[model samples]
Target: MLNIADTLYRWCREARPFALATVIEVSGSAPLPPGTALAVDTDGNAVGSISGGCVEGAVYELCEQVLESDETPVRASFGYSDDDAFAVGLTCGGELTVLVQRIDPTDQPHLANTLEQASDGVPLSVAQVVDGPPRLVGRTLSVLGGGSAYDGTLGSRRTDHTVADRVRALLRAGRTARVEVGGDADTCPEKLTLLVHTQAPQPRMLIFGAVDFAAALSQAGHFLGYRVTVCDARPVFATAERFPHADEVVADWPHRYLESAEVDARTVICVLTHDAKFDIPLLRSALGLPVGYVGAMGSRRTHEHRLERLREAGVPAEHLARLRSPIGLDLGAHTAEETAISITAEIIAHTNRGTGLPLSRVPGPIHGRVPADEAPAPSELLAV
Candidate 1:
């Protein structure tokens, strides 16, 4: 599993056969999402987690049994409402469908080759048939990025093509989902299925000023698993010593640097420089780019001024609407560290489509669903 890729590479290098268990589906408020995995070697060693802590003991023992029997590629379900007195289930309110499969290096050389990519950090999507007929279950199809050929197959050419198409689209969008095979577009959830898991390079978080807030926000961004970059026109301000957490510090003009930067659906940008020289040119392009988040640190007055300038420069109203001026959630933050927390909260809430409200106040899935109106204004994130 890509979650524990380095460990998998080491195991494969040692030719250690192991049993891999992955959560293929979840119902209710499971802490971990689908595609989370746990691995167990022949010696009963375990790596990674599936349900945080809810049903790990049972899943670990299941992995041990799968290793001993080697008759794996089996499915098991655990829930808190189980009637069996000695049943293993989640104490938290949720159910997990885990798929356990045996991976022997010598037995499945083709799969070992695929696992090797995990260590190299090459982007790829692995679609495994987690639910289907006995013959199709456990079958996997892998699609590697950079024009490389796909490895393995899901039984037939038609199935392979169908899964590959879905995987390619998901890879571009930096997403993963359960896809049905050998069914119409309106196929039910009970149909033959492939759990598609995508692995992309760490998404970019570009901070456009080497200020104190930038320093703290860069640390928060890195902690959130983004490859953070701090850029500024002033060489003295943009230095590794100043922004220790930034993956890269650039001393070029913010607009010029962003023009050449790699922008994707997962990229998020923060423009901390309120100066017109920096804000106007950089935001003119940033608001037009297809990034996940584009925010600016400023007061309401400054935001109004910035919007006016952007409008005068012929920036469309729709593009201006996408800009999250006065960056960060309205947490009444004062210090740079507090501001970083507010900003980071907004980023997380935006990414997950969260309500940015207290859990007690909200009555729905903890993990949010995509709303009909995909892009929400900064105020809409509050859900008042």
Candidate 2:
């Protein structure tokens, strides 16, 4: 749903009615995680996906039924049961619970506003009652940050208060979770299940070189939903005209720029500046930070020299171990575009904690929920 927020916002602004189905929960080896969504307009146009391509046809029919009959939100479960194997079962042998609801801007004002906020990259969460009393099925509440700024409400004030706090906790964790409220000490004894769909700001990819490979990698990073920034000391190479795909192009020393930039655990740093003067100082700053990846491009001999310089500069051996010299996967790439693919592949593998082995050789579930430390994909694509 977060990925299709722009499309949903456009539809809302045009007053177009649509049906949205979101994956509220999953068991076994589902392709997508819980907050993934699929939307179908009245004209039969669809955007986003919940189960890759496995159950999309069935989900589309479900959305059409909701829109045509104007039905209340309905929760449907699809799995690889022997009884329904020929029906809508996941080819990956997983189960998913989808909640389908009809949405109209005139009726769901809060939802429309939330979509707009999500499209603008504001960090927020939409807490919706997925299961409870008949009337509270689609009831929603929006909470931003830890503050009390909230819109919409559940039927009960106590429930809203309880769920708002939970939503804030999940937002802080940057996770989408299904929480059971209104049980025992909290509110009513009848438990209510709420799905908190959180939208966090995009993670960043800071490439410290404006070479041809950096240009291609910048485009690849953008396609992967990263806010990519290309930086270099040479103004002639770091111009926006050269790296058009980057969200920002800065002409500054790599170490100085990174020292002042906003970096987090989700940020990735790529050091393509092969020169010792630039690479050593920049890597010293990056390897000490909490960023997700720090890969430097160089040959095996260059890697040894860089490592010696890093150790001599007082960088600990453990910190130097975090640096990926001779960066990128073993793709035998020569062209700039192929080299970009190799680098991005290594970044994705590192972020996901993947082994960089061929999928065909890997055992166990082919698709699993992304780990907490990995960068989350848009609702429209599979995280893998």
In order, what lDDT does every prediction score? 0.79, 0.83
Once superposed on the true structure, which residue ranges of model 2 sit more than 4 Å away at CA? 81-86, 145-148, 184-190, 201-259, 263-384
TM-score of every model?
0.55, 0.53
Candidate 2 displacement at residue 279 in angstroms: 28
Model 2: which ten-residue window has the lowest total lDDT?
375-384
TM-score for model 2? 0.53
Kindly report which residue pairs in candidate 2 clash with one another.
none
Top of the candidates by lDDT: 2
lDDT of 2 by residue, 102-196 (tens): 98778767778888888888878888888888778877899863323577877665566667766765664466889877665434445788888
Clashes per model (N, Cα, C within 3 A): 0, 0
Query: Model 1 over residues 213-303: C-alpha lDDT tens digits?
Result: 9999999988777899999999988899998899999999999999999987678999999999999999999988978899999999999
Quote the lDDT for 81 in model 2: 66
* Candidate 1: worst-modelled 10 consecutive residues by lDDT: 363-372
